[model samples]
Target: MTLQSDQKEFRSWLGTCRFSKPADNGETVFGSQAVPTECKAVVAIWADSEEQYLNVLSLRMERYGYGIIQVDDIMPAPAWMVLKARNRTGPVLARQVSAEFPFALDLIENNPISQDDNVGDDKTLKVIVTTTLHRVEPLDAQFGVFPRKTLPEALTEWFFGPATPNIFANRADTGNTDDNPSRLYAVLDAGKIPNLGELLSSSGLEYQCLFNGKTASELAEVAPYLVKLEDNNSFTRQLFSRGKEPWFLWDRAGGIFIRTAATLTELRKHLRKFTRINRGKNDWVYFRFWDGPVLNALLRGMKSKPSHVATFTQCPKTLTFITIDPLTDTANRFIIDQKRLAGAKKQPVTPAALIDTVQLETETQVSTEKRLIIEAHREALFTAPGPDDASMELLKNEIPFLKTCGISKTQYLHDVLVFLIRNDLTGGKLSPEQRDILMHKRNNAPTKIRQLEKTVSA
Candidate 1:
């Protein structure tokens, strides 16, 4: 049938259909006006010619919103084609005209129209439309498909699915093992822990050996003086007095512990010192909790589940490390208080932050020098010399002129070498000693530039 005839038949069928319309606007036909705010609606336009259908669809989408209708030529037909045709068919076609107001699942079951539903008087076109009183989940106008899973699984899949690469595999080796493990995992919050590995990978922090646990006797057998529990807690003090080292009481089956000469006190002291010297108050301090269950899950490549690590926060005045006794699962906490040593106040900002500023100044100086050199040697540098002897004489004369231009010997040599190389001036180039000097200057250009930057900054 013609496109005009098909459209007229569809409109006639639409007029007879009982569906809710916006009370204010009198647009009864689909794609006639702006989609009603009261309900999410999709209109499927069909014609014998794909071009005609698409043309109408584009016009409607442009007039309305792009996503108002749930059809795109890029998408697969069967995934969204709710109605199907069977056996012999002529130019006549049937398109399902269902009002899935705020899209729902039982649409087919609750739909009043059937495949057998008749279109009055029009044999060439049939539009079987059904309107449901009940509202389904809100339709994503852009993507009409409703989520098949529950909210949590949907959210989990959305976040850690194929898009986010598994980053737990990138963790720095902590020498953890079944026998002589070198790390402990502690669970902080189960919910916020899933993306901790990604967070750490992006933070650009250098990995350091932070803590170690070993029996006092075992430590004594190796280096006893290095292992000391300097925790201010009374319980820890009492445990130490009783010669109860943390590793001695460790339950092999319950929790993992590392055996090393490194002490927690040393780690804390190092961090405190580093922060005092390098980090400002505005800089962030990150924390990671290594709990057994969460660690196992991460190692097993299960990123969808919650991780044991906590989110990084601003550095606190004091950091509390909690150790769970494997035997009783009771917590033994030790606080690392940030000590304000005498000369640890904020100092004058250094040149490290001014690297960009110094770089800009260096670039400007180099540009100015290049301009001066180009102007001074425009004729000798650019023009072809009379002969080999004349070119050699010109190069020899320019050497003194180059040095007097306030350019460093290294820079002068570099510029001269570049000019010679570009101009093919090397018939039997400089002597080995001169070549070596040029090579040295070329290699040390970066260092020279750095020194120049320092001088300028100072």
Candidate 2:
């Protein structure tokens, strides 16, 4: 394509551009024969601005599978007057050109220039213009709003002007692409006695309670707003449905949802007391019991005319719970011992020091049996013959017991060589030939194992 200074023209040569459309049976039909004349153009322009260029390019490439036109070469206007004239009018012409045209620019800044060309008095600029028509496929009717620029007409009027247009003057704003905020829900349970409302107010923990006597079906209506606490366990559901005892619910970080049949009275009496006693302490206490049966026992104990009395107590330093396990058919008791900071203090160690201590402990804890097995393998490999057929056969036979004991061939060979060199098994008695063979086998064990695998697979 050719663009010049004096005249408002751009010329382009498009050779054999391919176009495709899906047939009724979903097969793609290509070339000028399948497309209409008006739908086709010698040079197609898809965008004028960068945003438009990106939108059009994305649509053509991703949606319609169309390839953008690529420029082969750019030639500058020869004379200084011609260069100035073309630069003045190039940007205006560029906006009118279709993106499918090799010479089209999303913005005038995209116009090509010859690096060797100069506007100085000593150097002359040279312009080359080529225009050719190849098969033209119809442009999609959906994209007809964009105008097409004739390559020859755009290129011919070129003698004297500027080379590139100033692009920032007419730039369009593209807004920020931040994502929308996510919806959040609070967990709650239906309750009555020591009511959820009264409990929430007393406990000072943030919570939202659903209405009492709300059925599972009614709860389902607000499912999106209700964060669930129970998984496969249906005890909480039963308490919400049948029991008059108050139930509590709360959302915990890391997706831990809490639901219990313990009343605000029992919660304040037991769980909350634990939190309060440990408050401001450098240590914390955690429960080591199941929830379902414990809550069942507590609720059963709280009945107005209860058959069995469930006694609960919390010490300033400890909390205890006694309950029955229906699955095991036995009574269980658990204690939450208070944890407190020690009065004695010591200097804190750096991470490097901690790592060194751990590594030393690990090294000291290596099993004696493992050490003996490695030593045995090392002695066998060190004393074995050279790489002769008979020697290899004998060496292989020596490791059958080791293999059955779960040592890998490569690991066995590696341990054998390492132990031999360490003077742990061979006591540094290895001859030059034995030492060389053992080292060679250890180094090449991986390759040897691969060959063995291939042989076994074959």
**Candidate 2 TM-score to native:** 0.15
The 10-residue segment of model 2 with minimum total lDDT is 248-257
TM-score of 1: 0.15
**What residue runs in model 2 are displaced by over 4 Å at the alpha carbon?**
1-341, 346-355, 358-425, 428-430, 441-443, 446-458
User: Can you give the lDDT of residue 444 in candidate 2?
Assistant: 56
RMSD from true fold, candidate 2: 33.8
Q: Which digits, one per residue and each the tens of the lDDT, describe model 2 over residues 3-43?
A: 23423343321211222222232322222222321122222
Encode model 1's per-residue lDDT on 18-92: one tens digit a residue.
122223543333322333322222334343232233344444433432211112121112313322222111112
How many clashing residue pairs appear in each of the predictions shown? 6, 35
Total clashing pairs in model 1: 6
Indicate the residue-level lDDT of 251 in model 2.
13
lDDT of each: 0.28, 0.28
